[model samples]
Target: MSLSPDVFTYVADLVQRRAGIQLDAGKEYLVEGRLQPLAKEAGHPRVDAYVRDLRVAERPADVQAVVEALTTNETSFFRDGTPFRLLTEHIVPALRGPNGSLPRLRVWSAACSTGQEPYSIAMTLADCVGPDTSVEIVASDLNTAVLERAAAGEYSRIETNRGLPSSMLVRYFDAEGTGWRVREQLRRQVTFLKHNLLEPPAFGGQFDVVFLRNVLIYFDLPVKRQVLEHVLAAMRPGGFLVLGAAETTIGLDDGWERVPLERGAVYRAVPRVPAWGLPTATSPVPVVLPAARGPLTGAVPRTAPPGVLPHARPAHVPAGVPAPVIRPITPAPVRGETR
Candidate 1:
């Protein structure tokens, strides 16, 4: 059944307020499609009836259920392949620099859906860092239901098949009944929590790298600005920000300095300096060797000129590979190489 105009408006406004997702005029089917199952489970014969009850009054839990229902959670392990590639070949090496001990990375997988993205990140890090990994990952999504699933670290056969390399799958996941489960070693590397992108990240400290892919396209200009601001505040100086292929910070925020990668580009934030040139009371810039200035290392101010990068850029991601079909870019400025 179709959603009544009143029901649609109320749900749309509720979702927008709670998650910053815009459910415009043409998304009635989408709203209905997502909420109908929830309606049935709630014992309402129709979406309209369910929303009517919600309008009269609904608990926080009920509101959350509705918001989660409307939020898009389409994700796959290494969905587009570019972000992970950048992470391994470009971002990781840049952070490691050409010397010193391996640095522990603090990565925030924002808007992580059902664990794939974060799990994929964990696997990638594990592969790069080897047996003695010291990476700390916090994977957050507004939808608690997905967070719960993510924490469990289980995936169905079909889910495992997508974008997951067979070698990594066998190496990282132990077959559990019908679906595969992330091995404890890899699963322990990531912590999942419920988070909202419009607000400050719940984690008090700054992050070395953040994965915020494919989420901003759902938000309007104002909300997008707000989200970027929040991301900027949470990122350490020179920390990389990964956005979806179609998304960008070009006109939205000047704080970010774009760094182009092989297939897609990543942005880095310019850390603010204290007025006295002394370290700020909060998140003081730490003095370190030049090797420590890459994307996922500890925070430090960039002293280089605006056009120059604080860290050395790689020659290219893969030195030599046949040109495959590059993902189409919307002139949104998301496509590029990382070397």
Candidate 2:
């Protein structure tokens, strides 16, 4: 059943306004394809009639069903090897110390689908910080359906092979029939929660690293900036923000200083006050050794000088071979800002 252009526009506008998801003109097919099944399941005769019923329905469950169906949850294990490589080799070391005195290293996998991304991160952290390090992986998704699968930590063999290296795969996952299961220890390290990035981050305080990768492409410019701003606020100063290869913060917020790793890109927060100007009271006075400043002092700002966005230059690439691949693992809408 075909939906009138008028109905399509109405539904699309409602989705974009409420969910921050942009439905392009060509996505009419997607609306028809996804909603057709839902309409049938709901006992509606046709897509147009189903959409009409959805518009007048008091309960939001049907509306959410359409949104969830339309959402593209395509994700896989260890997607785009470069970022994970950077996370394990550089980002993790900088955030953590040798003794693991800090009880937690908080990492959020924003928009994590079916759990592959966070599990990949968990495997990397386990290897880098040692299995015993007290790291907390918070994986969240807008779709409750995917979150449940992620919490289960189960994966098909084909799904497991994507972006997953053979070596790390053997170390972190065990095979069960046609599926692979992430090790219980690695699985236990992560806590799966439901969250919507379009809403304010409800978890409070800053995180050491926030992974808001490919999900941004679904949003328009304003939503993207708003989401990035909120994600940045949740990230601690000097903490890492990883984006997808095709993505960049260049045109968006200036608060993030893009730090180019040997393999991939990471954005570090620009301190409100430069370290040289920080008051001793608010600083990590005891933690700063003369040697610690050596790295910061010599390091150039990742962003462009003065007015430029951080361009990918050869000089920014660290000298040395790339690190090994780790392994493939395997929210609410609020009208107003809710704390």
Candidate 3:
């Protein structure tokens, strides 16, 4: 049954209030489609009745479930290829500690729906760093349901086929019936937790890199600023922040400056200086990067390489291929430029 306007408004407001996600007027159809099964399982038999119960009873679990259903978890291995390449070639090399040794790096995959994003990060780092390097990846999502799946690090055949190269499949996964499980070695690098972006930072220490991509579009201006504030607080000085190609730090926050690499852009935080002329203890002068590509489209391009599909998987599968050594990805040279 279709949701009445009043019920839809009530439900939409509830989601915005609780989870900071904005559902527009036209999203009643989406609510109807996603919530009908939940309603039936909840024994309401109708979405309007379920929404009414949600309003009157104010059950926390049901509210969370609704928000989770509404939240888009659309992602794939290397969802955008440029970000991973930029990470390997530029960001990791640029990172250094006070003593000049490569510091133990901590990365946060905010809104990480499942294991793919974080695991992909680990795979990228593995290609660059020695096996014994100390790197930690914390993957968080508001949806506990997805967090559970992420912790397991298992994907069905269809999931494996989405942006997961056959080489990576053979190298990083163990065959389990019709599914593939992320090897324990790779899984150990990432930690999964349930987290809400609207809340204060609680996932432990400061991060060197925060992947806050493709999530801010779901929030209104106030919520977007609030989440960005929290994210800024969670990052160490001079740390890097990567947003979706469509998102930027303009207007919402001015502290981040753009780093334009050919693969994609990443942002680095500028340390705030005191009114006095003297430099603060921790604020390092920000490094300037080359001019960025023209304004980003905010949409993931459909024509990425074989393993990094944002929407769908390949129709056929190749089996038993050995994983190729992942080479460090560099930017394509300019036509008139000499290295």
Look at candidate 3 and give me any clashing residue pairs. 163-307, 246-298
What TM-score do all the candidates reach, one by one?
Answer: 0.81, 0.77, 0.80
The 0-to-1 C-alpha lDDT of every candidate, in the order given, reads: 0.82, 0.76, 0.80
Lowest summed lDDT window (length 10), candidate 2: 323-332
lDDT of 2 by residue, 1-339 (tens): 457998799779877976789998978888888889988987986888888888886367877777778888898888887888898778877876555454568899999989989999988887777545678888888888889989988888889778888897889889888888888988998889888889887887468898888888899999999998888777777788998877888889887988967546688876544444322334321222232123333333442134211222234436452422112111123478667
Per-residue alpha-carbon lDDT of model 3 for 228-265, expressed as tens digits? 88888888777899989888888888778888766465
Provide the RMSD of all predictions against the true structure, rounded to 1 decimal. Answer: 12.8, 12.1, 16.9
Q: After superposition, how far is residue 162 of candidate 3 from its true place, in Å?
A: 0.7
Task: Candidate 3: list runs displaced more than 4 Å.
Answer: 97-100, 280-339
Local error of candidate 2 at residue 311 (angstroms): 33
In model 3, where is the ten-residue run with the lowest total lDDT?
Answer: 287-296
Give every collision pair in model 2.
195-331, 196-331
CA displacement after TM-score superposition, residue 304 of candidate 1 (Å): 18
Residue 185, candidate 1: Cα error in Å is 0.4
Q: How well does candidate 1 score on lDDT at residue 76?
A: 97
By TM-score, the better pick of 1 and 3 is 1
Full candidate order by lDDT, most accurate first? 1, 3, 2
Backbone clash tally for model 3? 2
